[model samples]
Target: MKPWILGLTGGIGSGKSAVAQHFIDLGVHLVDADHAARWVVEPGKPALSKIVEHFGGELLQADGQLDRTALRKRIFANADDRRWLEALLHPLIGQEIMQYLARAQSPYAILVSPLLIESGQHTMTQRVLVVDAPEQLQIQRTMARDQSSDEQVQAILKAQASREERLRHADDVLLNDRDLAWLQSEVERLHHFYLSLRGGQV
Candidate 1:
């Protein structure tokens, strides 16, 4: 049977990864765009060579790998640079994600992407799940998790689609401002819902 594909998205530090992990624990296959993004740009990959050629070697670490910190700073400092990078990387990431989904073996698969809404890839899925929290909480969590400054976190948030925009597209919303138990219950409920949908019981 073709697996049911769910596009899971959320603002930075809204516990999207934690929620995806819950699905993984429930035996749902997972395809993470961030992981695919990283894989496509690994040292020997074509994407890496293209990035080095376009952005120059300054964006590379001593090991000849992409220096994410340097690249992030450069991209955030200029909209044109950010768009240029996205134009190059987004298609590559999308291709990798599609490949993973094609081979997914579980009853259903979850595609976790921070840019799912903005990139329009959510259209490829049967369900759109959003992990949501207040902007202040999202900012705090992001700063704490990444050890980034408030300004940097805000910049990243500004680059992403707003909470309302994401919620408008959601088929399921998981409020992650509370405790893990609540998150677990939501995940379990959604798992069953997705299974039912896949079984033509929707």
Candidate 2:
């Protein structure tokens, strides 16, 4: 049977990773685009070869691995460079995601992607679940978690779709502003609901 796919997304620092982990603990297969994106461009991957051809040898470390920090600095500084990198990586990431979903053995699979809405990939899911928090909270959380400066956090947030835009696109919205216990309960409820929808008693 084809596994039902749930596209899970949120703004940076919105606790989307926590929500994804909750679903995973409930036995839902997870295909994380961030992980797949990295996998596709590893030293020996075809995606890395394409990237090297386009971006030149300077983007590589002395050991031949992709220099992620260098790429990040370049992409954020130049819109054209960001687009160029995305064009090369996104399709390869999509292919890997599809392959993972095809091999999933669970009742449903969750694709956790920070850029799911922005990239227009939410259309691929059976449902869209958005993990959300207030902008102030998001900024604070990001700063704390990533050890990033306010300016850096703000810039990253600006690069993503606004909170309102993501909420509008959500079939299910998880407000993650409270304590972890509250978030846990919400995830449990959602898990049961998902199972019920799949014709299983939860």
Candidate 3:
């Protein structure tokens, strides 16, 4: 049988990476959709080739790497383009994640995706664990990390599931408004809780 899968998600800059890291440190296997997304789009990959076919070589640098900025701009401006791109990438990412989870050796494995809830990945998991912070905090963190303009940050936020929506769907929630020590404690607490969920023998 497939081991229990914990779906982890949050909005941009909600500290999901930090949360996931703690789970990793505690030995949970991680199947990251973000990594799969990047992998599937690597140069010469079929997904990348298809993306280039639809979006054009303008989205390719001279080195044949994806011009992510140009592609991001296009998808953000056009809803249809965004859907097409999602259709192309999401399945490939999901397939890779499934392969990783199938071999998971931990009490449970984490399926980490920014779009876990929005893209219906939560339904595939046994539990949904959300990392949450205030919307304003998300905006501030994203802007500082990405050097993104306020408008750009807001637009990315708008495209994601609302913070309230993510919380409402969560089987568990980690509030990430505090310091690293606090976050570490929360993850540790949840780590044991999950282990107990596997009958406390891990």
Candidate 4:
């Protein structure tokens, strides 16, 4: 049977990873879109050959791996490039996500993606969970964790869906302005809640 999928998303630095970890601790299966994206473009993948063909082989590293940092800068700076890359990769990533979810042994699976709403991946899920934090907190946390400049973070924020828009689509919201203990407790609470929603469960 197809497992119930809970889509988890949040803005940059909104503690989505931490929340996802808690769910993992409780034994929920998870398929992360970011990982799937990377997988689709790996060295032997057809997607990598197309990228090298279009963007030139200079984007590949010494080990023949795609230089993701260089590719990210190129795409983010140009809308056309961004659209082209997305068009090539989203379907492949979606297929990977579905395959992983189909193999889930848990009561439910989580599809964790930063772009769950923006990329329409939430349509595959039965519920959408949003992890939220104030914009200032998001900026600060991202800067601290990623060592990114304020301007870089701002550009990423601008590219993403607005906070209000994300909340509008949410079936559940986890406000992550609190401490780790509180976040873990909330994850545990939601885990049980999700288990209760299983197809044959009362």
Question: Which structure among the candidates has the greatest TM-score?
Answer: 4
In candidate 3, stretches whose alpha carbon ends up further than 4 angstroms from where it belongs are 147-152, 199-202
Candidate 3, residue 49: lDDT = 92
Better of 2 and 4 by lDDT: 4
lDDT of 3 at 158: 94
Would you list the clashing residue pairs of candidate 3?
Answer: none
Error of 2 at 7 (Å): 0.6
Worst 10-residue lDDT window for candidate 3 reads: 193-202
Q: Global lDDT for candidate 4? A: 0.93
RMSD of each: 2.3, 2.5, 2.7, 2.0
Best-first order by lDDT? 4, 1, 3, 2
Give the per-residue lDDT digits (tens) of candidate 3, residues 135-189.
Answer: 8888899999999999999998998998889999888988899999999999999
In model 4, which regions exceed 4 Å deviation? Answer: 199-202
Per-model CA lDDT versus the true structure:
0.89, 0.87, 0.88, 0.93
> In candidate 2, what are the lDDT values of residues 1-202, reduced to their tens digit?
6778889999999999889888888889999988898889898898888878987899999999999998899898999989998898888888898898888788778889998988877767888889999999999999999999999999999989988888898888999999998998999998878876652222
Q: Write candidate 1's Cα lDDT for 41-111 as tens digits.
A: 99999989988888898988888889999999998899998899889988888889988988989888889
Q: Candidate 1, overall lDDT?
A: 0.89
State every prediction's TM-score relative to the real structure.
Answer: 0.87, 0.91, 0.87, 0.92
Which residue pairs in candidate 1 have backbone atoms (N, alpha carbon, C) closer than 3 angstroms, thus clashing?
Answer: none
Predicted structure with the largest lDDT when compared to the true one = 4
